[model samples]
Target: MKPEIAVLDIQGQYRIHTEFYRSDTPQNTIILVNGSMSTTASFAQTVKNLHPHLNVVLYDQPYAGQSKPHNRHQTPLTQELEADVLLELIEHFDVQYVLSFSWGGTAALTALASSPRRIEKAVISSFSPLINVPMRNYLERGRRCLADCNRTQVGNLVNDTLGKHLPSLFKRFNYRHVSTLAEHEYAQMHFHINQVLSGDPQCYLKATQRIEIPVLFINGEWDEYTAANDARQFAYAIRDSQFVSVENTGHFLDMEHKQASHISKIALLDFLKPPAPVITRPAQRLSVAL
Candidate 1:
């Protein structure tokens, strides 16, 4: 890691933490926003592997990871604010591509919604489409669950919710690694959830349709509830989108699957490097798009 690690002020309102991976030249610039509970370290495989030729920059999303907390007591910083930060960072570093996972995907699209012209190609992995049916219902339950946070409920959340997609091998896995994060980090993570689950509550659906950049969405096949089917529904709504369903993986495609790595290398890389995509609604709408 020959790159520098530091933070830059964004209009003096918010701070953007940036990490430049050395070796990867200026061929491609990817701004990766991890999930609510994750950070740049979680995406180490991609960041290190795509280096020398690809300038991969990963940052903390709002209150998650190592980012500064919100200025006010707001659950999530405005999607517009996130976009503004991304535009500033992109312009500063000349970034054109992005890879978003989970909540970060929502943030990425939200940023794109606010400023469609800032990004060119985006690879969204195992992201939440925020569909009205499942999204609302699950989130409503999650809020109630958090209200009564206890060991039993936490265990249930891990098992019934997060563990629903994993194989039996994961059932026996130790949770000590999961509990390693500090208290503030955990609370901040919950704060990020409020952003993802209920943040922009009044405008989430509209934002999804507003995405104009060419997006490649990759979803796992065996994910319990959040799987390729969910990604397919997300693909239908977006005007210009591509969906690739991983055959033998769960929700954690980046870590659990091998073919996904290949997809990023071959198909994903090919699509990203070329003429820029039109940054608005497509010229025409197809019934079975993406």
Candidate 2:
């Protein structure tokens, strides 16, 4: 399904590029939030699959893709700012569900905690509110590489870390893309890593505690980047949250290790799919011909 494209102006400060995939029938809308370094274009397949069942909204966050910040003053994208932008979009589009991946979950969680009236349910993948020690180390390494203008080191860092358990071909592709990042892109990376490093655990805890809607948190069993245990802890903080670990997988649950992708997909779809409407037949009046 082709999406209706639009550029949303956020209080006239910046514009975010968005794609709306409407279902044949009017259905509840679900927003697909991208992870760091990912864009709306990456969700092409997802939009196609979901548009048939639900209205899907895909947008590029500021500094991520087409959502470039016009105001140079607001250069770096912060978690709070992203959350505010997401909330505005939710209100504007009347979104009812959310599916966030990796770093994208940060904004989703924050928005749901702050203003969850419009969001009934959410699915968060490979995300943890608190940054564990391993995650911090990886972030710090990536930050240093960016700071030192060693962009090429990013590929090796990721291959040896987050992408370690991914397929070899995926590792090569990841390396090619990440290792050759442009100067401006590297700067954005620095900002993202720094924001996470500086995040307050207490703040995340409070925010998660505020969440009252049902949420499903999925993480790879072998994930060391975000640490599956940490993701479990984050899920535990919420009043209504379920945590699932995809077995034989690493940070990227979609990598299809031992059919992990299939498992994760099934779990997500089962949780997100709205219940089928019940059909009832009117009782026929008894024939009173007698």
Highest-TM-score candidate: 2
Tens digits of per-residue lDDT for model 1, 1-290: 66677777778876666787744346667787776556666677677546655777877655555564533334446555666677677777778888877666766777777654557788887765544464455556655555444334444555455446554554434133234444444555455556666555535446768777788887777665456666666655678889877777766664554566665556556667675577896588659858
Candidate 2 structure quality by residue, lDDT tens digits, 29-70: 999888876778656555654667788899987665666544
Per-residue error for 164 in candidate 1, Å, reads: 5.3
How many clashes (backbone atoms < 3 Å, residues ≥3 apart in a chain or on different chains) does model 1 have? 5
**Cα deviation of 245, candidate 1, in Å:** 0.8
How many residue pairs clash per model? 5, 0
TM-scores of the candidates are 0.74, 0.88
What's the true lDDT of residue 47 in model 1?
A: 70
- Report, for every candidate in turn, its global Cα lDDT versus the true structure: 0.63, 0.79
Q: In model 1, which runs have C-alpha deviations exceeding 4 angstroms? A: 68-80, 130-141, 148-160, 163-205, 275-290
The reply for model 2, stretches above 4 Å from the true place, is 69-74, 255-258, 280-290
